[model samples]
Target: MHDTEALQAKFFWFSPGDMTDVRQFFAPGRVNLIGEHIDYNGGHVFPAALTRGVSLWVRPRADGVVRFFSVDFPETIEARVDELEFRPSDGYANYTKGVIKAVQEEAGTLFCGGDFFYMSNLANGAGLSSSAAVEVVTAAAVRALMAYPLDNARIAVLSQRAENDFVGVNCGIMDQFAVAMGKAGHAIFLDCQTLAYEWVPVTLGDYALVITNTNERRGLADSKYNERRSECEAALRRIQEILPDIQNLTQISIDRWDDVETHLASEPNLLRRARHVVFEEHRTNEAVRVLKAGRLAAFGQLMNDSHVSLRDDYEVTGPALDALAEAAWSFSGCLGSRMTGAGFGGCTVSLVRRAAIPEFEEHVRVAYADKTGLQPSFYVSEIGDGVHEQQKEGLEV
Candidate 1:
């Protein structure tokens, strides 16, 4: 948990302001439990928000100058509300500037700038959606500052727009939505096609969700993420000729794909990409059903299956992710393990028995280090709430 007093003191150190008009906001990073590489395919995704995420302290400025500071970086970035644009050199601050521009455009009105101080416990490039957390938290603070009449769901949509339009990453809505509207002790079952969702209770009786980072440092924009998306699109276009009503790859059932697979035999790569989407979509839906029924073993099996499809069919998981996941799978206490996120290199989430967490960690740690020659980081995940104000007593903006 984050220390409010400590964060407030750091905020004062950075901004040199009294606590009179400062409002604090928090947005959690998310872990996709069973869904991998399927959100863009218009499939159902199962994701839960983690306790680790980004927190921001905002003090509205009288002028239009917005100053951004982070505990993770040395330099404070400054921008004008009227001139928010993406700059490659700006690094992480681009997410903040992107959200500010998105809010101004979506709300159809300009808002005052603010001094934004950020602090986060989330590991960047760990497949924990840190960028999404930053975007959502910024949107929440800007909404509070400008009194925008948008709900949490709308906040998610606009944040996604920031990433897609401003940040130039063609990510789906799962990351932003999971971070913006997550409920504690529950995994959201969301349909990417229709955006219909429901909260499913995560009842892991004696099991824990452990996230292991490969420390390979893969960037989403520079990685093969966009290439996989393009391949899926190409497959969808070819399949559309056979079934014109079909919208996305996930819309095709496994049996339906068996009937249509012969048509795409000429393009082997496209076949594999589409195969992953269709089958992975089925696995995700079944995982949700078994999880709701407390069939944890079945849910774990589905997680393992999701990883295989992601590895063989989608061709996303690299050597580091594969080594970590395979090591976890060899442990007897681990119920399931799979590579999560966009996955050229990132993290693997494993469901392990609570009593065996120590052994599980050591086993995987030694094995992964031996195979990859790099140390991996581990975090025991705690499900948490979405973006909201951290209210301070007797303080109002």
Candidate 2:
């Protein structure tokens, strides 16, 4: 845990003035445990919030000017609440600006603007939802300052809107939702189709959840993410010609895929994309069952399957991710390992025996660096709670 008093002092250092009205807020980064690349397809996603994320310290301004400073970034950005627009050059501050605009559209004009100072432990481009974390934290700060009457779920939806419409990333709701509504020590079983969700206990028993970062940065906005989404949409259009009742790729059951396969056989890429969505949905459902039944090994196997489908079918996992996952899989201490997040580049989630964590880390680190020539970073994280205001005695807002 970070020292609240120290963070407050840092905020004063940045602002260089009175700190009386400053308030603190936090939102967590998320890691998808199994389901990958299927959230947009209206399939289930199992994600949990990590202990590491973004933290913000804010002091509201009455002049409608918002100022942002980040310890991790090089410059301080300033903007007006009414003139917020997408500026690719602004970098991380764009998330804050987007959230302010989203809140204004949701609830009339804000009563005030604020100075935001951000500190994050999450690695950039590691696929840990750092962007979503910034958006949610900014939303939480605005809601608290303006008393905007928005709940956590609503906050999540608006944060997603900021990403999709304001930030120009065609992301689904899973990242924002998981970051906004997560509970400590559990994973969220979410149906992307209906937004229905349940919290399942993360009972690893003798195993720990280890995240291995390949250290290869992913530029999702410029990457093939949108192309994949377009491919899936095309596939759905084709399937509707026959099964008009199906709304998404996941709605077509795996048992019925063979029949549907004939319809998509001619379009090889679309067929592969649709196949990954359908089978991944099936794996996610069974993973939940095995997870709840205390079948740890079975759940691990499903994680491995999810990675293979993402690599071969979805074509998202690149060499760095593949090397890390393959190295972890070779270790005897690991029950299962797979690439998580948007793939191409990022981290892998592995279930490693608690007793062998040291050996597991060393073995994978050496093998992965040998193959990819990039040193990998590892984190053994516990599930953590969602976004909220930090309560200090006499300082609670």
Instruction: Output the lDDT of residue 130, model 1.
Output: 92
Which pairs of residues have clashing backbones in candidate 1? Answer: none
lDDT of 1 by residue, 36-113 (tens): 888888999999999889988888998998999987888889999999988898888999999999899988988799
Model 2, 201: alpha-carbon shift in Å?
Answer: 0.9
Quote model 1's TM-score.
0.96
Per-structure clash totals for the candidates: 0, 0
Task: For residues 280-357, write the lDDT of model 2, one tens digit per residue.
Answer: 999999999999999999998999998999999999998999999899889998989999888888899999999999
The alpha-carbon deviation from the true structure for residue 266 of candidate 1, after best TM-score superposition, in angstroms, is: 1.1
Candidate 1 wrongly placed segments (more than 4 Å) = 1-10, 219-221, 393-397
Query: Per-residue error at 320 for model 2, in Å?
Result: 0.6
Query: TM-score for each prediction?
Result: 0.96, 0.96
